[model samples]
Structure formats: structure tokens, C-alpha cells
Target: MMAADETSARLTAVLDKVRALGPTLRERALEAERAGRHSDETIADIDATGAFEIGSPAEFGGYEFSVRQQLDVVTEVAKWDGSCGWTVWAGASTNWIPAGSGARVVEEVYKPEWVGPRVAGSSHFPASRGRAKRVEGGWQLSGGPWTFGSDALWAPFTNLGCIADDGEGPYLVGAQVPLGELRFLDDWHVAGMRATGSVSCKLAADELFVPDHRCVDFRDITGGNLDNGLKGSLWQAPSLGWSFSLMAGMSIGIAQGALERFLERSAGRPIRGTTYKNQLEAPLTHLMLAEFHSKVQSATLMTRANAEETDRLGVLAAAGTPADPDYMQRFSARVLVETAYAAKWCAEAVELLQRNSGSTAIMDFEPIQRAWRDARVVTLHGALNLEALSENYGRLMAGVQPHNFAGITTLDRFAPTAPNKAV
Candidate 1:
């Protein structure tokens, strides 16, 4: 293993690359989405930078960097374009789960390099259904159209969920399928995150075959027994917390971009009527800008602190110390909900800025308008909903314990504060 200093330096280098590419990538994102084309070049640049490898296990050719580093990369990329950061962050995050019984299948999908572990599954509302039958060597997966699997264009590996029929229960099983094995449907036309190329995909259930090694019992990870190094490292410290923290970072970045555009446009052009010289001189504009800056700063600080805490926890976990499961779950849920709140905060900031900026801000191609749409869409992600998440955390805190999505149900109480409030 490399020295800690070396690892830090490597992470810094990756962040620098992401920062340098921010402007170009952001521009590319706008162009690609506007032109209705795939973001092939942007995706390639991310892959080449090894940004995705930050979350993989070192044993599997990854940097195994701290979760903070991962968030740093995602946040910086997000400053340029929300969809690019979202796509990269989502793909990287998915690899944290152990390969389980499907190790070989994962290996096959991620062969030669660990840069892109494509996960083409969608978490759209109203989940879809699948059929799984036990067969000789493995299981046969038959599924029609799965949304978001269209992202497989950039992913070498894909996951298809199906209902299992062992009579034990109906369970969702993830299988690693080569991109070549799936067909993409041209159905990902959307208002936001359009560049994600997240189209519907059709997998032939009858012809689909998964070997035992490529099939993992998703339940195994609930016990924390999978072989991915992150299970023992800081990356897995708060589990869900890291995802929430990253989401917060993305929201902050989007807000920051919107704020910058607001300031620039306000300086150049004033509202048509009764304004002193420029919009900047308008008291209302000044107040709204101040509020925007304050909230974005607050969100950015919370995101950073949350990521650092997660990193600390990961290091402790890697050292053979386990975090309190309940504490970790609450922490995770809190950060995710906080991220949504931050997105809402940013959306509110943008609304104030837009209202003051006049009719031109509503132009279809305006950056402020796009930022508004993106933030609105981001707030809808399951991870960021505050009320439900708080209830989950509250249940654990109140000792009314229940199984988290991971199936671990141990409660460890920690002080409650604002979502992503520094521990």
C-alpha cells in the first residue's frame, strides 16, 4: 500500500484535473444537452482522469481514497455541470457494494480497467417488475424495459433486477451484464439531466443468463461481510451519509454557478424600470444576493464538514473499528435529507435572483433558468427527501428500530442537529 501522503497527493492531482476541466466540461454539457446528443467526450474525460476509481477497492485496482476525496471530486465537477457530476458520482457510488456471489461477473464487466463500472438501472418512481427463475448454473433474468439502463452506453457493466422464485421470498437480485448484451431504447428525452443519456433498455429475459459468481445475495452486505475493501475502510464509515453529503455538494455547486450568473447579468444590465443605474444598486437585488451567498456558503460548509467526518469514520473502520450502525444510519439519512434541503435553499435563492433579474432571466438558454430546473429535479431524488428520512432517523433514535435498506438494525444515538450540521 502507498503511504498516506502519497494517497493524499494522488487525490489532490485528481481534483486539480477535475477543476481544470470544469469550464470546458460545463460548456460541453450545455451543448450536448441542447443539441440532443450523447456526452461521449465528457464521459471519456472523466474516465481518463481515474475519478471513478476513487470508490473502488485497491485490491480491484482502485485508489480506495477517503470518502472526502470522492466528494471533493464530485463537488468540483458539479461546479461545472450538475448532470456530469451526478452521472459520475452515481456510477462511482454503486461500486461500493461488494460484488458478492457475482464477483466474476463484475470482474468481467470491469476488466482491463476499473475506470467505468457502468450501472444502467433507474430509480424512477413506480419501480418496475422482473421475473427470475433458478436454473442449472445460475438464474435466468427476463425483463422488458428498464428506465435509466440507457446509461449503459458509457457503462461496460449493467445491472438488471428480477423477482427471485426460490420460494424463500420475492427478492431483487442484481446481475452484471455486459453492455453488448443489452439493447437501448431511445426514450431518455427529458428537460433536465438530458445529457445523462439515461434511456430505457431492453434485456432479453429468456436469453439472459447469470452465473453464480456474477450473482450476489444483496442481503450479504447487510451483515457487512462482502469483500470490497470499502467495507473495512473510511469510505463505508457512515454508509448512506457519504451519498447525502455528496448530493449537498452538488447542490451547492449548482447554486454557486447560478449566483455567479446572477451577479454578472445584474451588473451589465439593469431592470427596465425605476432602478438606480444597475440591478446591483437595487435594494431588493442586493438583499437577495446577500441571502443567496449566505445560504450557499452555509450549504458548502456543511457539505465539507460532513464529508470530512465520513472520511474520519472510514479511516477508523479501516483500522478494524466499526461505527455504531444506528448512528451511521441516522448520520447518513440526515446528510441526504440535508442535501435536499440545501437544494431547496439554492432553488429559493435562484428564484429570488430570477424574480429580480427581470424577464430576460426566463430565456430558455439562460444559465439561471437551467440552474433552476436542475436544482428542482435534484430535490426529487429519493435520498434527499427530508421528512421521510428524518422519520427513519427518528425511529432509530427513539429505539423504535427497523431495518434500513441495508437490513442492518442496530441503534446508536447521536445528538440531532440540522441536516449535515457538523458533528
Candidate 2:
């Protein structure tokens, strides 16, 4: 482990890197959005900051920054460009392969070192796309065109979902496969988050062979039952649950961006049909700004709360005591609820600002408009939707397991899996 001061210094450097890159990233935001992909320069700039390697193991030359640090950087980047933030999170997604059943394979994947390669993964509900047949040397993987294949264009290997061909006890399995084996569908067309390049792709069912070394039973990954090598490691912390905090951080940034733009654009502008020459002169505008400020402040508090909890749990995991199931549920639920609510708050805050700013601010090309769109789109993520999250948390309290979630038909639908212990 890094000494406390060293970790602080490294985190500060990374935060500074993102802060310095903000202007350039924001300058090129529209260009990346129109192209539906990050420019090579943009990706390189962010990667240079080590934002993508935040969760990597220390042995592999990774900084192994804490979850709080990861979310801090994520929030900072998203403030500049929404897609860039999502892509950075995707870049770090490989850090969570959950070492138990696939420990050897994961070790082999990172054997060469952890500097540049992009790692992408997919996990969808019900295992509808693929089949896994146990072969002599490994599993024969057939069928996939997995959705949510973020960073697919740059990633060399993508962990794909498949179901083992057991007669009565078929199980879900994950196999890391070469991106070349899959064909893309060019989908990801959305209102906001347009630059994410999150398109659907196809993998031939049963055509590709996955050696046993590259496979992990979804159950093992979910339960954090990895090899001894990772018993007391930060990587043992479940990655899926962190998705909430990741999204929460992004929400905080998007809201912050919107609020900044709102203040900049509103203060000097004249309000029509009013005696006031500028928005800042109006008592109502002062009230409006105060309320919006309060909203962002509250949302940011929740966002920081999620990040702190993640750090606490990570420390426990690193100390050889995995997080308790109930605590995980509360944290996970908080992530979903807080991120979604924060994103929604940001979306509405911008909408209110946009409305009060008069006709000129209504232009489609406006930055506040962009922030509004981005926040709205971010809140639409399956894991970040406020309604679904509230219901899930409520159901958890009512004794229904999240495994029985409406969209989830099976237990392994989500992985780096969590325990099914009573909530």
C-alpha cells in the first residue's frame, strides 16, 4: 500500500491533470458529440492523466487510487464533457474481473502490464444472447451482439456474457473475448450522452472457443470468492455496486456545469417586462439562484456520501473482511437513489434557469441546453433511474431480494455479484 502522503499526492496530481485538461475537453465537446466518439487526442489526454487506470492493482503499476479518488476524478471530467467521463469509467471497468473462478485468466490478461490497453465488458439481464458449451479444453462460446459494449472500438478484449449448457442447472458465465469476433450494430443514438459510442454488437453463437483460463463463473465473481492472492485486496470490492457512485459523480459534475453556466449567463442578462435591468437585480432571481444553489449543494452532499461509503467498504475489503450484505445493499441503494435524484435535480435546475433566462438562451446550441440534455440522459441509465431504484430499495426493505428485480429473471443477471443474504 502507498504511504498516506504518497496516495494524497498521486490523487492531487490526477485531479490537477483533469482540471488542466478541462478547457481543451470542453472546447472539443461538441465535435466529439457530433462524431459520436472521442477524438484520439482527447482519449490520449485523459489516459495520460491515469484516470482510466484508477482501479488497477498496485502490482501492475497502477496507482490503485481509492474509490473516493476515482469518483472525484470522474466528477471533475464529466463537468467538462459527459461522454469523456463515461468513457473514463469504461476504461477502468476492467479492474473488477473478481478473481475467484477466473483468477488465473485475469492474471494472464494483465501479465503484460497495465499501461495502455482498453478493457471493456458487457452484462445484460436474462442471458438472452449467447450459449456456452463446455468443450474439451474450454467453453465453446456462441451467440452475442451484446448491448452496452462501451469503448468497443478501442478495446482489444471485451468480457461477454454466455450461459453454460447444463441440462437442468444451466448457469451464467462470462468469457473475455477478442473484439474482432463481434460485429457492431451502430446503435447508441440518444438524446444526451451522444458521444458515448455505446452501440450494440454481435458475437457468433457457439463459433468462438473460450479456454477455461479466460472464463469465470458469474457466481464466483458475484460472491467475491476469489483466489488467496486477492483476499485482502481493494479489487475484492464489488465493481457493479460502484456503478452508482460513478454515475453519481457524473451527475454532480453535470449539475455543477449547468449551475455554472446558469450563473454566468443569467447575471448580466436583462429580464423582459421588468424594471430590473439585469437578472441579478431582481429579488426573485436572487431567490431562484439561492434555491438552485441549495439543490446542487444537497445533491453534492449525497454524492460525497456515496463516495465516502465506498472508501469505507473498500478499506474493510482490503483488510480481509468483505463488506456485509446489508451494508452493501444500503450503499448500493444509496448509489442508485442519490445519483438518479442528483441527475434529475441538475436536469430540472438547468431547465428552470433556461426558462427564466428569456428567449435568447433557448437556442439549441447553448451550453446550458447541452448541460440540461446531458443530465436528463444520464438519469435515464437503467441503474440510475430514480423510480426503479426507489422501488428496489423499498422492495429490499420489504424482504424481496434484488435478485428478484423485475428486469432480472435470474440471480446471475448482474455481476461482480453480491451475496443473496437477507437484507
Candidate 3:
């Protein structure tokens, strides 16, 4: 592992670089949205910052930074451009999943010269209208119409999720395929996060052969099967907790950006209908801004605490002392619930600021409006469904384990526990 001081220095340097690019990212945000993807210059500039390597395996020229480090980088980037931050987050999220797939899989995914994220994935099986069949050497995968292929445009490989049965029963599996082998659909049209280029992806051929080395069990990915000989304290981190932290960072950053923009644009502006010559002087303006600031501060604190705890547990695991299974489960459940709340608070803050920014704030060129849209779309994510997470947390608090994985955490529940019942 890199020395702690060295890691901290590197993180500070990278953050400084990203902060320097703030104006450029903000300048290109509107253009990225209009073009349905980030500009080449924008991508290259971010790649230059080495932000994408935050979650990749350190053995493969990656940073392998802690979850908090990753969060800070992502939040800083997001404060300037939500889409760029989101793309980096998606890349970071995908790297850790396959980093433990085995040496061969890791080697194949992370090339020495890869400038962007080593991999981008569209592995949400529930949204995948496809299949996988167990073949002689590996699996013959046929899946498609996988939605939300974030950061796929610049990644060298894309991970595809499928349901496969190997005699005993069915299971969720992810296959790493070269980007060239996958076909992308131009279906990314959306109200927000348009620049993420989260288009749908499909197999270019009817079925493709993916050797066993290129595939991993979804259960293993979620459960942290680091016995693959990889040596990073981060590899032992809670998978769901780490992933949710990225989203929370992005949410808080966007809200913070919106607040900054509101303050900038509202300066010395007339109240229009009121006698106040400067809206900033209005008592209502102070109230709204204070509430927004308070909410963002609260979300930031919760997210940081979650990230720190994740890192602490990871370090313990790396030292060969694993957290108790029950405690880990409860910790993961709490992280999920807290993440949802953070996203909610951030979204509300952005909306509050946007609504008070006046009718001109809705213009496409206004950063505040974009932040509002991006924050809303983020909150609408399936995994961040506040109600469901709240219910599960409640159940856990009441001494009842979660009935389903819900993509939050997977612990020994790989196969179907009961016969499939028609919904």
C-alpha cells in the first residue's frame, strides 16, 4: 500500500488540479449537455487529473485511495460540472467490482495506457433484457438493452450483467467485454445528466463467448471476495457503502454549486415586485440561503462520517480482522439509509435555491437550473428510493434482516431461496 502521507499528498495535489479546472468544466457544462456528452477537451482534462484511478486496483497503476479520498475528488469535480463528476464516479464504481475478479480479469481490464476509467458497466440485471448460457470454457452471453451505460464512451471495456444457470440453479454474473464488442444505442436523451452519456448498450453479435476468467459472480462482487490476492485495504471496504458515497458526494457538490451560483447571480439584483433594490438584502433571501447552506452542511457531514467508517473497517479487514458479519450488515444498512437521506437533503437544497433564484434562473445557460435538474434526477435513481431504504433501515432496527438484497449488500444469498412466484 502507498504510504499514508504519500496518499494524502497525492490526493491534495489531484484536488488542486481539479479545482484549477473548475472554470473550464463550468464553461463546458452547457455544451456537454447540448452535445449529449462531454467534449473531448473536457474528458482529456479530467483524465489528466487522474481522478478516474481513485477506485481501481493499485497494482494496476491505480490510486486505490480510500472512500473518503474518492468522495472528495468526486465532490470537487461535481461542484463545477455534475455530469463530469458523475462519469468519474461511475468509472470508479465499476473498477472496484472487477478488480477482485482474479488476476487475469484485472490484467485484461486495466491497460497501462488507458487514460479514462478502466471499465464502464451497464450491469443492472433487472433492467437487462438479456441472458447468459453456461458454455464449455465459459459462458455464451446474450444480453442487451442494458440501460445507463455511464462513462461507456471513453472506457476500454464495459461490464455486462446477465442471469446464468450452471445446472444447479440461476445466478447473477457480470462479463467484461471490450468496448468494441458492444453496440451502443443513441437513447440517452434525458432532462438532466445528459452529458453523462449514459446510453443503452447491447451485444454487437447474437451471442459472444466470454471465458470464465472474464466473468465474476455478482454475489462475490457485492460480498467483497478479496481472496484473489489483491492487497489493498480499500478492497475490504463495504461495496454498497463505497458506491453510495459517490452519489452522495455528487449530490452535495451540486447543491453547493447551486448555492454558490445563486449567491453570484443574485448579487445586487432587484426584487422586481418589491421595493428592495437588491434582492440579497431581503430577509426572505437570507432565510432561504441559510436553510440551503444548513442542509448541504448536514449532508456533507453524514457522507464524510460514512466514508470514514468505511475506511476504518477496510483498514481493519486488511489487517486480517474482519468486521462481524451481523455488524457489517447493519453498518451497510445504515449507510444505505444515510446516503438516501443525504441525497434527499441535497436535492431539497438545490430546489429551494433554484426556486428563489427568479424566473430567469430557468434559462438553459444558468448553472443553478442545471444543478437543480441534475440533483432531481440523481434523487430519482432507483437505488436511492428514500422510502424503500427507510423501510429496510426500520426493519433492521427492529431486529429483522432485509428480505432482499435490493442491490444494497449481498451476503451468502447467491441463489434463489424460494420458488419463483409470479408478481
Best by TM-score: 3
RMSD after CA superposition, every candidate: 4.3, 3.7, 4.4
Point to the candidate with the largest lDDT: 3
Question: Please, what is the TM-score per model?
Answer: 0.86, 0.88, 0.94
Q: Write the per-residue lDDT of candidate 1 for residues 1-423, one digit (tens) a residue.
A: 557899999898988888777778766766777755445667778877777677665655677676677777777766677777677677666654434324454456445563354444442222445555778998777765766653476777666655565887565555666677778777767777676677777774346877765655545533345554224364346655655677677777777777777777878575676757777777877777788888787777777888888777767676876565545656665566567678788767767777777788787667777777777777776555667666766665665653334221222223333333222
Q: Output the TM-score of candidate 3.
A: 0.94
- Model 1 stretches astray by more than 4 angstroms: 35-37, 98-106, 109-111, 114-120, 123-126, 204-206, 229-235, 397-399, 402-423
Could you arrange the candidates by lDDT from highest to lowest? Answer: 3, 2, 1
- How high is the CA lDDT of each candidate model? 0.65, 0.70, 0.81
Clashing pairs in 2: 100-226, 142-205, 142-206, 143-204, 143-205, 144-203, 145-201, 145-202, 145-203, 222-417
Q: Which 10 consecutive residues of model 2 have the lowest summed lDDT?
A: 406-415
Model 3, which residues run further than 4 Å from truth? 405-423
- As a whole number from 0 to 100, the lDDT of residue 11 in candidate 3 is 95
lDDT of 3 by residue, 122-175 (tens): 755544565788779988988577778888888888877777777887777777
